[model samples]
Target: MSGFASWIGGALGWTLGGPIGAAIGFAIGAAVDKATSKGLLLEPPKRGSQQRRKRVDPVYEKRRRRKTVREKQAQTKSGDFEVSLLVLSAIVMKVDGEVSESEKDFVRNYFTKMYGKQRANHAFKLFNGLLKKEDISTRQICQQIQMYMDHSSRLQLLHYLFGVTKADGHVDESEVDLIEKIAGYLYINDRDFQSIKAMFYNPVDSAYKILEIDKSATNNEIKKAYRKMAKKFHPDKLEHLGEEHMKGANEKFQKVQKAYEQLQKERGF
Candidate 1:
Protein backbone atom coordinates (compact mmCIF):
# COMPACT_ATOMS: atom_id res chain seq x y z
CA MET A 1 0.00 0.00 0.00
CA SER A 2 0.98 3.64 -0.48
CA GLY A 3 2.37 5.61 2.44
CA PHE A 4 -0.72 7.81 2.53
CA ALA A 5 -2.96 4.80 2.79
CA SER A 6 -0.79 3.33 5.50
CA TRP A 7 -0.90 6.53 7.57
CA ILE A 8 -4.68 6.82 7.19
CA GLY A 9 -5.11 3.20 8.27
CA GLY A 10 -2.94 3.76 11.30
CA ALA A 11 -4.84 6.91 12.26
CA LEU A 12 -8.10 5.03 12.03
CA GLY A 13 -6.72 2.41 14.39
CA TRP A 14 -6.17 5.00 17.13
CA THR A 15 -8.83 5.14 19.89
CA LEU A 16 -9.99 8.59 18.86
CA GLY A 17 -13.68 8.04 19.60
CA GLY A 18 -15.33 11.35 20.41
CA PRO A 19 -16.43 14.35 18.35
CA ILE A 20 -13.30 16.32 19.25
CA GLY A 21 -11.03 13.50 18.22
CA ALA A 22 -12.87 12.97 14.97
CA ALA A 23 -12.71 16.63 14.03
CA ILE A 24 -9.03 17.00 14.88
CA GLY A 25 -8.13 13.71 13.19
CA PHE A 26 -9.95 14.63 9.99
CA ALA A 27 -8.29 18.04 9.86
CA ILE A 28 -4.83 16.65 10.54
CA GLY A 29 -5.22 13.85 8.01
CA ALA A 30 -6.31 16.28 5.35
CA ALA A 31 -3.38 18.59 6.11
CA VAL A 32 -0.85 15.78 6.15
CA ASP A 33 -2.19 14.29 2.94
CA LYS A 34 -1.97 17.63 1.20
CA ALA A 35 1.54 18.37 2.47
CA THR A 36 2.94 14.91 1.66
CA SER A 37 1.14 13.93 -1.55
CA LYS A 38 3.59 15.62 -3.89
CA GLY A 39 6.56 13.92 -2.33
CA LEU A 40 7.54 10.55 -0.83
CA LEU A 41 4.06 9.13 -0.19
CA LEU A 42 3.04 8.58 -3.83
CA GLU A 43 4.49 5.23 -4.92
CA PRO A 44 4.99 4.57 -8.62
CA PRO A 45 3.59 1.37 -10.09
CA LYS A 46 5.81 -1.65 -10.74
CA ARG A 47 6.93 -1.24 -14.35
CA GLY A 48 7.86 -4.78 -15.41
CA SER A 49 6.66 -8.38 -15.41
CA GLN A 50 6.67 -10.49 -12.25
CA GLN A 51 9.76 -12.47 -13.38
CA ARG A 52 11.70 -9.22 -13.92
CA ARG A 53 10.72 -7.92 -10.49
CA LYS A 54 11.78 -11.20 -8.86
CA ARG A 55 15.41 -10.36 -9.65
CA VAL A 56 15.17 -7.52 -7.10
CA ASP A 57 15.96 -8.33 -3.45
CA PRO A 58 12.65 -9.08 -1.77
CA VAL A 59 13.93 -8.50 1.78
CA TYR A 60 15.48 -5.15 0.98
CA GLU A 61 12.36 -3.97 -0.83
CA LYS A 62 10.17 -5.01 2.08
CA ARG A 63 12.39 -3.30 4.63
CA ARG A 64 12.63 -0.15 2.56
CA ARG A 65 8.87 0.08 2.24
CA ARG A 66 8.42 -0.50 5.93
CA LYS A 67 10.83 2.31 6.74
CA THR A 68 8.95 4.62 4.42
CA VAL A 69 5.68 3.72 6.09
CA ARG A 70 7.13 4.43 9.51
CA GLU A 71 8.43 7.80 8.40
CA LYS A 72 5.06 8.75 6.97
CA GLN A 73 3.35 7.69 10.16
CA ALA A 74 5.72 9.79 12.26
CA GLN A 75 5.18 12.77 10.04
CA THR A 76 1.44 12.43 10.27
CA LYS A 77 1.54 12.13 14.03
CA SER A 78 3.80 15.18 14.32
CA GLY A 79 1.46 17.19 12.13
CA ASP A 80 -1.50 16.19 14.24
CA PHE A 81 0.32 17.14 17.41
CA GLU A 82 1.17 20.66 16.19
CA VAL A 83 -2.42 21.23 15.15
CA SER A 84 -3.65 20.17 18.55
CA LEU A 85 -1.11 22.46 20.23
CA LEU A 86 -2.43 25.44 18.33
CA VAL A 87 -6.02 24.68 19.23
CA LEU A 88 -5.32 24.31 22.93
CA SER A 89 -2.96 27.28 22.88
CA ALA A 90 -5.74 29.45 21.54
CA ILE A 91 -7.91 28.44 24.43
CA VAL A 92 -5.15 29.07 26.94
CA MET A 93 -4.36 32.49 25.53
CA LYS A 94 -7.99 33.51 25.72
CA VAL A 95 -8.47 32.31 29.28
CA ASP A 96 -7.82 35.86 30.51
CA GLY A 97 -10.57 37.20 28.21
CA GLU A 98 -8.41 38.11 25.21
CA VAL A 99 -5.68 36.65 23.01
CA SER A 100 -2.90 39.19 22.64
CA GLU A 101 -0.97 39.74 19.42
CA SER A 102 2.25 39.11 21.33
CA GLU A 103 0.95 35.72 22.41
CA LYS A 104 -0.06 34.91 18.84
CA ASP A 105 3.40 35.91 17.60
CA PHE A 106 5.06 33.66 20.14
CA VAL A 107 3.20 30.67 18.79
CA ARG A 108 3.82 31.76 15.22
CA ASN A 109 7.54 32.09 15.83
CA TYR A 110 7.57 28.72 17.50
CA PHE A 111 6.01 27.10 14.45
CA THR A 112 8.34 28.88 12.08
CA LYS A 113 11.41 27.88 14.05
CA MET A 114 10.32 24.29 14.30
CA TYR A 115 8.71 23.79 10.91
CA GLY A 116 9.82 25.91 7.89
CA LYS A 117 8.22 29.10 6.62
CA GLN A 118 5.69 27.42 4.33
CA ARG A 119 4.36 24.92 6.82
CA ALA A 120 4.53 27.51 9.59
CA ASN A 121 2.48 29.97 7.58
CA HIS A 122 -0.03 27.28 6.74
CA ALA A 123 -0.26 26.16 10.34
CA PHE A 124 -0.58 29.74 11.61
CA LYS A 125 -3.39 30.37 9.18
CA LEU A 126 -5.13 27.23 10.33
CA PHE A 127 -4.57 28.25 13.94
CA ASN A 128 -5.99 31.73 13.34
CA GLY A 129 -9.05 30.31 11.61
CA LEU A 130 -9.63 27.89 14.43
CA LEU A 131 -9.07 30.62 16.99
CA LYS A 132 -12.13 32.46 15.69
CA LYS A 133 -14.42 29.64 16.72
CA GLU A 134 -15.63 29.89 20.32
CA ASP A 135 -16.73 26.33 20.99
CA ILE A 136 -13.47 24.51 21.77
CA SER A 137 -13.44 22.54 25.02
CA THR A 138 -10.32 22.18 27.15
CA ARG A 139 -11.58 18.88 28.56
CA GLN A 140 -12.13 17.33 25.14
CA ILE A 141 -8.72 18.40 23.84
CA CYS A 142 -7.01 17.09 26.98
CA GLN A 143 -8.87 13.80 26.74
CA GLN A 144 -7.80 13.31 23.12
CA ILE A 145 -4.17 14.11 23.91
CA GLN A 146 -4.15 11.90 26.98
CA MET A 147 -5.36 8.93 24.96
CA TYR A 148 -2.48 8.96 22.48
CA MET A 149 0.53 10.52 24.16
CA ASP A 150 2.57 8.88 26.90
CA HIS A 151 2.89 10.51 30.30
CA SER A 152 6.33 11.97 29.70
CA SER A 153 5.28 13.44 26.37
CA ARG A 154 2.24 15.01 28.00
CA LEU A 155 4.52 16.51 30.62
CA GLN A 156 6.67 17.96 27.90
CA LEU A 157 3.56 19.47 26.29
CA LEU A 158 2.51 21.01 29.56
CA HIS A 159 5.97 22.46 29.86
CA TYR A 160 5.62 24.13 26.48
CA LEU A 161 2.20 25.50 27.38
CA PHE A 162 3.72 27.05 30.48
CA GLY A 163 6.48 28.53 28.38
CA VAL A 164 3.87 30.20 26.21
CA THR A 165 2.16 31.72 29.20
CA LYS A 166 5.46 33.06 30.46
CA ALA A 167 6.40 34.66 27.15
CA ASP A 168 4.75 37.78 28.52
CA GLY A 169 6.93 37.57 31.66
CA HIS A 170 4.12 36.52 34.01
CA VAL A 171 1.37 33.88 33.94
CA ASP A 172 -2.13 35.03 34.65
CA GLU A 173 -3.96 33.28 37.48
CA SER A 174 -6.70 32.32 35.00
CA GLU A 175 -4.15 30.70 32.68
CA VAL A 176 -2.77 28.71 35.56
CA ASP A 177 -6.28 27.56 36.51
CA LEU A 178 -7.05 26.48 32.95
CA ILE A 179 -3.78 24.56 32.74
CA GLU A 180 -4.57 22.83 36.03
CA LYS A 181 -7.93 21.86 34.54
CA ILE A 182 -6.18 20.56 31.41
CA ALA A 183 -3.86 18.54 33.58
CA GLY A 184 -6.78 16.99 35.44
CA TYR A 185 -8.58 16.18 32.20
CA LEU A 186 -5.40 14.69 30.78
CA TYR A 187 -5.06 12.42 33.80
CA ILE A 188 -1.79 13.97 34.91
CA ASN A 189 -1.20 13.38 38.59
CA ASP A 190 -1.21 16.35 40.94
CA ARG A 191 2.45 15.96 41.75
CA ASP A 192 3.51 16.06 38.11
CA PHE A 193 1.25 19.06 37.48
CA GLN A 194 2.74 21.03 40.34
CA SER A 195 6.21 19.94 39.36
CA ILE A 196 5.84 21.44 35.90
CA LYS A 197 3.99 24.44 37.32
CA ALA A 198 6.93 25.35 39.54
CA MET A 199 9.21 25.47 36.51
CA PHE A 200 7.37 28.59 35.31
CA TYR A 201 5.56 30.08 38.27
CA ASN A 202 7.39 31.68 41.14
CA PRO A 203 6.33 30.04 44.40
CA VAL A 204 7.61 29.79 47.96
CA ASP A 205 7.65 25.99 47.56
CA SER A 206 9.67 26.01 44.34
CA ALA A 207 12.12 23.31 45.41
CA TYR A 208 9.48 20.90 46.66
CA LYS A 209 7.22 21.48 43.68
CA ILE A 210 10.12 20.94 41.31
CA LEU A 211 10.92 17.65 43.00
CA GLU A 212 7.21 16.83 43.05
CA ILE A 213 7.23 16.20 46.77
CA ASP A 214 5.82 17.85 49.86
CA LYS A 215 7.90 19.70 52.42
CA SER A 216 7.22 16.97 54.97
CA ALA A 217 8.81 14.36 52.73
CA THR A 218 12.10 12.97 54.00
CA ASN A 219 15.39 13.81 52.28
CA ASN A 220 15.64 10.28 50.90
CA GLU A 221 12.24 10.52 49.29
CA ILE A 222 13.08 13.87 47.77
CA LYS A 223 16.32 12.56 46.33
CA LYS A 224 14.59 9.56 44.81
CA ALA A 225 11.93 11.72 43.23
CA TYR A 226 14.59 14.01 41.82
CA ARG A 227 16.40 11.07 40.22
CA LYS A 228 13.21 9.69 38.74
CA MET A 229 12.18 13.07 37.35
CA ALA A 230 15.64 13.53 35.86
CA LYS A 231 15.35 10.32 33.90
CA LYS A 232 11.82 11.13 32.81
CA PHE A 233 12.74 14.60 31.49
CA HIS A 234 16.10 13.66 30.00
CA PRO A 235 16.57 14.99 26.48
CA ASP A 236 17.52 11.54 25.20
CA LYS A 237 14.15 10.22 26.26
CA LEU A 238 12.43 12.65 23.89
CA GLU A 239 14.67 12.15 20.84
CA HIS A 240 11.90 10.49 18.87
CA LEU A 241 9.75 13.60 19.18
CA GLY A 242 12.14 15.58 16.92
CA GLU A 243 15.03 18.01 17.39
CA GLU A 244 12.99 21.00 18.47
CA HIS A 245 11.14 18.94 21.02
CA MET A 246 14.40 17.58 22.36
CA LYS A 247 15.69 21.13 22.80
CA GLY A 248 12.62 22.07 24.84
CA ALA A 249 12.90 18.90 26.91
CA ASN A 250 16.51 19.67 27.64
CA GLU A 251 15.58 23.10 28.93
CA LYS A 252 13.08 21.59 31.34
CA PHE A 253 15.56 18.94 32.37
CA GLN A 254 18.06 21.63 33.20
CA LYS A 255 15.50 23.32 35.40
CA VAL A 256 15.06 20.02 37.17
CA GLN A 257 18.76 19.91 37.87
CA LYS A 258 18.79 23.49 39.02
CA ALA A 259 16.02 22.76 41.47
CA TYR A 260 17.95 19.81 42.83
CA GLU A 261 21.02 21.96 43.32
CA GLN A 262 19.02 24.57 45.15
CA LEU A 263 17.71 21.92 47.53
CA GLN A 264 21.19 20.51 48.05
CA LYS A 265 22.49 23.95 48.96
CA GLU A 266 19.65 24.63 51.37
CA ARG A 267 19.87 21.21 53.05
CA GLY A 268 23.70 21.00 52.85
CA PHE A 269 23.37 17.59 51.20
Candidate 2:
Protein backbone atom coordinates (compact mmCIF):
# COMPACT_ATOMS: atom_id res chain seq x y z
CA MET A 1 0.00 0.00 0.00
CA SER A 2 1.08 3.58 -0.49
CA GLY A 3 2.49 5.46 2.49
CA PHE A 4 -0.59 7.73 2.68
CA ALA A 5 -3.05 4.80 2.51
CA SER A 6 -1.06 2.90 5.14
CA TRP A 7 -1.04 5.92 7.42
CA ILE A 8 -4.82 6.37 7.01
CA GLY A 9 -5.54 2.69 7.76
CA GLY A 10 -3.17 2.65 10.72
CA ALA A 11 -4.78 5.78 12.17
CA LEU A 12 -8.24 4.27 11.77
CA GLY A 13 -7.15 0.98 13.33
CA TRP A 14 -5.47 2.78 16.22
CA THR A 15 -8.69 4.70 16.85
CA LEU A 16 -10.79 1.53 16.88
CA GLY A 17 -8.46 -0.60 19.00
CA GLY A 18 -5.26 0.38 20.86
CA PRO A 19 -1.57 1.00 20.07
CA ILE A 20 -0.55 -2.69 20.42
CA GLY A 21 -3.43 -3.93 18.25
CA ALA A 22 -2.59 -1.36 15.57
CA ALA A 23 1.08 -2.39 15.61
CA ILE A 24 0.16 -6.10 15.30
CA GLY A 25 -2.29 -5.37 12.46
CA PHE A 26 0.35 -3.38 10.56
CA ALA A 27 2.99 -6.12 11.09
CA ILE A 28 0.65 -8.88 9.80
CA GLY A 29 -0.31 -6.83 6.73
CA ALA A 30 3.34 -6.06 5.89
CA ALA A 31 4.42 -9.66 6.37
CA VAL A 32 1.60 -11.04 4.22
CA ASP A 33 2.44 -8.58 1.39
CA LYS A 34 6.20 -9.35 1.61
CA ALA A 35 5.67 -13.11 1.71
CA THR A 36 3.31 -13.03 -1.25
CA SER A 37 5.59 -10.77 -3.30
CA LYS A 38 9.17 -11.98 -2.50
CA GLY A 39 8.75 -14.99 -0.09
CA LEU A 40 10.11 -12.79 2.77
CA LEU A 41 8.51 -11.66 6.04
CA LEU A 42 8.49 -7.99 7.05
CA GLU A 43 8.45 -6.18 10.44
CA PRO A 44 5.97 -3.55 11.54
CA PRO A 45 6.58 0.09 10.59
CA LYS A 46 7.95 2.45 13.26
CA ARG A 47 5.60 4.92 14.91
CA GLY A 48 7.56 7.98 13.62
CA SER A 49 8.54 6.56 10.21
CA GLN A 50 6.14 8.73 8.19
CA GLN A 51 6.93 12.37 7.55
CA ARG A 52 3.84 14.55 7.33
CA ARG A 53 3.37 16.28 3.98
CA LYS A 54 3.65 20.03 4.01
CA ARG A 55 0.42 22.02 3.47
CA VAL A 56 0.34 23.06 -0.21
CA ASP A 57 -2.95 24.97 -0.48
CA PRO A 58 -1.50 28.26 -1.58
CA VAL A 59 -4.92 29.75 -2.42
CA TYR A 60 -6.27 29.18 1.07
CA GLU A 61 -3.09 30.54 2.64
CA LYS A 62 -3.27 33.65 0.48
CA ARG A 63 -6.89 34.19 1.38
CA ARG A 64 -6.06 33.94 5.09
CA ARG A 65 -3.26 36.52 4.66
CA ARG A 66 -5.54 38.89 2.79
CA LYS A 67 -8.24 38.56 5.45
CA THR A 68 -5.72 39.62 8.10
CA VAL A 69 -4.76 42.69 6.06
CA ARG A 70 -8.41 43.69 5.53
CA GLU A 71 -9.09 43.36 9.24
CA LYS A 72 -6.14 45.68 10.00
CA GLN A 73 -7.39 48.23 7.47
CA ALA A 74 -10.87 48.19 8.97
CA GLN A 75 -9.39 48.73 12.43
CA THR A 76 -7.36 51.70 11.20
CA LYS A 77 -10.37 53.30 9.56
CA SER A 78 -12.43 52.87 12.71
CA GLY A 79 -9.68 54.44 14.81
CA ASP A 80 -9.39 57.42 12.49
CA PHE A 81 -13.13 58.04 12.49
CA GLU A 82 -13.30 57.86 16.27
CA VAL A 83 -10.38 60.25 16.73
CA SER A 84 -11.83 62.79 14.32
CA LEU A 85 -15.28 62.65 15.87
CA LEU A 86 -13.92 63.10 19.39
CA VAL A 87 -11.76 66.09 18.51
CA LEU A 88 -14.52 67.86 16.59
CA SER A 89 -17.05 67.12 19.31
CA ALA A 90 -14.68 68.51 21.93
CA ILE A 91 -14.13 71.66 19.96
CA VAL A 92 -17.87 72.21 19.61
CA MET A 93 -18.46 71.59 23.29
CA LYS A 94 -15.85 74.17 24.25
CA VAL A 95 -17.08 76.70 21.68
CA ASP A 96 -19.78 78.26 23.79
CA GLY A 97 -16.80 79.54 25.76
CA GLU A 98 -17.33 76.90 28.45
CA VAL A 99 -17.27 73.14 28.98
CA SER A 100 -19.79 72.26 31.63
CA GLU A 101 -20.08 68.95 33.48
CA SER A 102 -23.20 68.13 31.51
CA GLU A 103 -21.35 68.72 28.25
CA LYS A 104 -18.53 66.42 29.39
CA ASP A 105 -21.03 63.76 30.39
CA PHE A 106 -22.70 63.99 27.03
CA VAL A 107 -19.38 63.45 25.31
CA ARG A 108 -18.48 60.53 27.57
CA ASN A 109 -21.80 58.81 27.08
CA TYR A 110 -21.63 59.34 23.34
CA PHE A 111 -18.17 57.76 23.10
CA THR A 112 -19.07 54.87 25.38
CA LYS A 113 -22.19 54.00 23.40
CA MET A 114 -20.42 54.17 20.05
CA TYR A 115 -17.11 52.41 20.88
CA GLY A 116 -17.62 50.51 24.12
CA LYS A 117 -15.53 51.07 27.24
CA GLN A 118 -12.05 50.13 26.08
CA ARG A 119 -12.14 51.82 22.69
CA ALA A 120 -13.88 54.84 24.18
CA ASN A 121 -11.01 55.19 26.64
CA HIS A 122 -8.53 55.03 23.79
CA ALA A 123 -10.50 57.68 21.90
CA PHE A 124 -10.28 59.96 24.92
CA LYS A 125 -6.51 59.52 24.92
CA LEU A 126 -6.47 60.57 21.26
CA PHE A 127 -8.69 63.51 22.05
CA ASN A 128 -6.28 64.71 24.71
CA GLY A 129 -3.38 64.40 22.33
CA LEU A 130 -5.11 66.59 19.75
CA LEU A 131 -6.36 69.11 22.29
CA LYS A 132 -2.90 69.56 23.77
CA LYS A 133 -1.55 70.78 20.45
CA GLU A 134 -1.71 74.60 20.40
CA ASP A 135 -1.67 75.02 16.64
CA ILE A 136 -4.91 73.16 15.91
CA SER A 137 -7.45 75.53 14.36
CA THR A 138 -11.14 75.06 15.06
CA ARG A 139 -11.89 75.87 11.43
CA GLN A 140 -9.42 73.25 10.22
CA ILE A 141 -10.95 70.64 12.52
CA CYS A 142 -14.41 71.46 11.17
CA GLN A 143 -13.14 71.13 7.61
CA GLN A 144 -11.59 67.76 8.37
CA ILE A 145 -14.87 66.57 9.85
CA GLN A 146 -16.71 67.70 6.73
CA MET A 147 -14.25 65.88 4.46
CA TYR A 148 -14.50 62.57 6.27
CA MET A 149 -18.20 62.22 7.07
CA ASP A 150 -21.01 62.10 4.52
CA HIS A 151 -23.78 64.67 4.18
CA SER A 152 -26.46 63.00 6.32
CA SER A 153 -23.95 61.87 8.93
CA ARG A 154 -22.48 65.37 9.02
CA LEU A 155 -25.92 66.75 9.77
CA GLN A 156 -26.46 64.27 12.57
CA LEU A 157 -22.99 65.01 13.91
CA LEU A 158 -23.83 68.71 13.95
CA HIS A 159 -27.07 67.88 15.73
CA TYR A 160 -25.13 65.93 18.34
CA LEU A 161 -22.75 68.86 18.65
CA PHE A 162 -25.68 71.16 19.25
CA GLY A 163 -26.99 68.72 21.81
CA VAL A 164 -23.67 68.86 23.65
CA THR A 165 -23.67 72.66 23.73
CA LYS A 166 -27.25 72.69 24.95
CA ALA A 167 -26.63 70.00 27.58
CA ASP A 168 -26.31 72.70 30.21
CA GLY A 169 -29.76 73.97 29.22
CA HIS A 170 -28.41 77.11 27.55
CA VAL A 171 -26.85 78.00 24.21
CA ASP A 172 -23.93 80.38 24.66
CA GLU A 173 -22.62 82.77 22.00
CA SER A 174 -19.37 80.85 21.67
CA GLU A 175 -21.27 77.67 20.97
CA VAL A 176 -23.25 79.42 18.26
CA ASP A 177 -20.04 80.72 16.70
CA LEU A 178 -18.49 77.26 16.74
CA ILE A 179 -21.57 75.72 15.14
CA GLU A 180 -21.55 78.44 12.46
CA LYS A 181 -17.96 77.59 11.60
CA ILE A 182 -18.86 73.91 11.32
CA ALA A 183 -21.90 74.66 9.19
CA GLY A 184 -19.73 76.71 6.87
CA TYR A 185 -17.21 73.90 6.50
CA LEU A 186 -19.94 71.35 5.87
CA TYR A 187 -21.43 73.66 3.25
CA ILE A 188 -24.70 73.61 5.14
CA ASN A 189 -26.27 76.93 4.23
CA ASP A 190 -27.31 79.16 7.14
CA ARG A 191 -30.95 78.34 6.38
CA ASP A 192 -30.45 74.60 6.62
CA PHE A 193 -28.68 74.81 9.95
CA GLN A 194 -31.47 76.92 11.41
CA SER A 195 -34.00 74.44 10.04
CA ILE A 196 -32.27 71.61 11.93
CA LYS A 197 -32.01 73.66 15.08
CA ALA A 198 -35.69 74.58 15.06
CA MET A 199 -36.70 70.96 14.61
CA PHE A 200 -34.70 70.00 17.66
CA TYR A 201 -34.83 73.08 19.87
CA ASN A 202 -38.07 74.91 19.26
CA PRO A 203 -41.09 74.37 21.48
CA VAL A 204 -43.94 72.65 19.61
CA ASP A 205 -46.54 75.38 20.16
CA SER A 206 -44.13 78.24 19.46
CA ALA A 207 -42.84 76.65 16.26
CA TYR A 208 -46.29 76.22 14.75
CA LYS A 209 -47.19 79.71 15.85
CA ILE A 210 -44.07 81.22 14.26
CA LEU A 211 -44.50 79.37 10.96
CA GLU A 212 -48.13 80.60 10.65
CA ILE A 213 -48.90 77.27 9.04
CA ASP A 214 -51.18 74.55 10.28
CA LYS A 215 -50.09 71.08 11.41
CA SER A 216 -51.95 69.74 8.37
CA ALA A 217 -50.32 71.79 5.64
CA THR A 218 -50.07 69.92 2.35
CA ASN A 219 -46.63 68.82 1.14
CA ASN A 220 -46.84 71.26 -1.78
CA GLU A 221 -47.49 74.21 0.47
CA ILE A 222 -44.68 73.18 2.77
CA LYS A 223 -42.29 73.00 -0.14
CA LYS A 224 -43.52 76.36 -1.42
CA ALA A 225 -42.93 78.07 1.93
CA TYR A 226 -39.46 76.51 2.23
CA ARG A 227 -38.44 77.69 -1.23
CA LYS A 228 -39.84 81.17 -0.74
CA MET A 229 -38.02 81.65 2.55
CA ALA A 230 -34.86 80.07 1.15
CA LYS A 231 -34.77 82.62 -1.65
CA LYS A 232 -35.62 85.53 0.64
CA PHE A 233 -32.81 84.85 3.13
CA HIS A 234 -30.24 83.17 0.91
CA PRO A 235 -26.87 84.65 1.94
CA ASP A 236 -25.95 85.19 -1.71
CA LYS A 237 -28.97 87.45 -2.26
CA LEU A 238 -28.19 89.40 0.90
CA GLU A 239 -24.53 90.01 0.02
CA HIS A 240 -25.25 93.60 -1.11
CA LEU A 241 -26.75 94.29 2.32
CA GLY A 242 -23.21 94.23 3.86
CA GLU A 243 -21.64 91.62 6.13
CA GLU A 244 -23.45 92.71 9.32
CA HIS A 245 -26.94 92.58 7.80
CA MET A 246 -26.10 89.44 5.80
CA LYS A 247 -24.95 87.64 8.94
CA GLY A 248 -28.18 88.41 10.77
CA ALA A 249 -30.21 87.48 7.69
CA ASN A 250 -28.38 84.15 7.46
CA GLU A 251 -29.14 83.38 11.08
CA LYS A 252 -32.78 84.22 10.58
CA PHE A 253 -32.88 82.05 7.46
CA GLN A 254 -31.61 79.11 9.44
CA LYS A 255 -34.38 79.67 11.97
CA VAL A 256 -36.97 79.65 9.21
CA GLN A 257 -35.70 76.34 7.86
CA LYS A 258 -35.68 74.84 11.34
CA ALA A 259 -39.26 75.93 11.91
CA TYR A 260 -40.41 74.54 8.58
CA GLU A 261 -38.80 71.16 9.20
CA GLN A 262 -40.35 70.99 12.68
CA LEU A 263 -43.78 71.72 11.28
CA GLN A 264 -43.28 69.20 8.51
CA LYS A 265 -42.28 66.49 10.96
CA GLU A 266 -45.32 67.18 13.12
CA ARG A 267 -47.66 66.93 10.15
CA GLY A 268 -45.96 63.76 8.97
CA PHE A 269 -45.02 65.41 5.68
User: Judged by lDDT, which candidate is best?
Assistant: 1
For model 1, the stretches where C-alpha displacement exceeds 4 angstroms are: 1-76
**Pairs in clash, predicted candidate 2:** 95-174, 96-175, 194-254, 195-257, 195-258
TM-score, one value per model:
0.73, 0.48
Cα lDDT tens digits for candidate 1, 1-269: 24433343343323334534444434454554553453423332445646643466889999987676555444435545565677678779888987777888899888888877866776676567566666776787677667555666677778878878987776689998888898898788898898888988759989889888888888788799899989988987767667866678888899899988888888888
> What local distance difference test score does each model get?
0.71, 0.54
Model 1 lDDT, residue 19, Cα: 39
State model 2's lDDT.
0.54
Candidate No. with top TM-score? 1
Model 2, position 207, has a per-residue lDDT of 59
- Tens digit per residue, CA lDDT, model 2, 1-269: 34423332322211222322222234334433533344222334568758886787999989987676445333323333344456567667655555677776776777676556754554454444444444446665555445434444454456666767777787787777778777888777765576556545665564543344455667787777777756655666534323423443455567667767876786677
lDDT of 2 at 26: 40
The local distance difference test score of model 1 is: 0.71
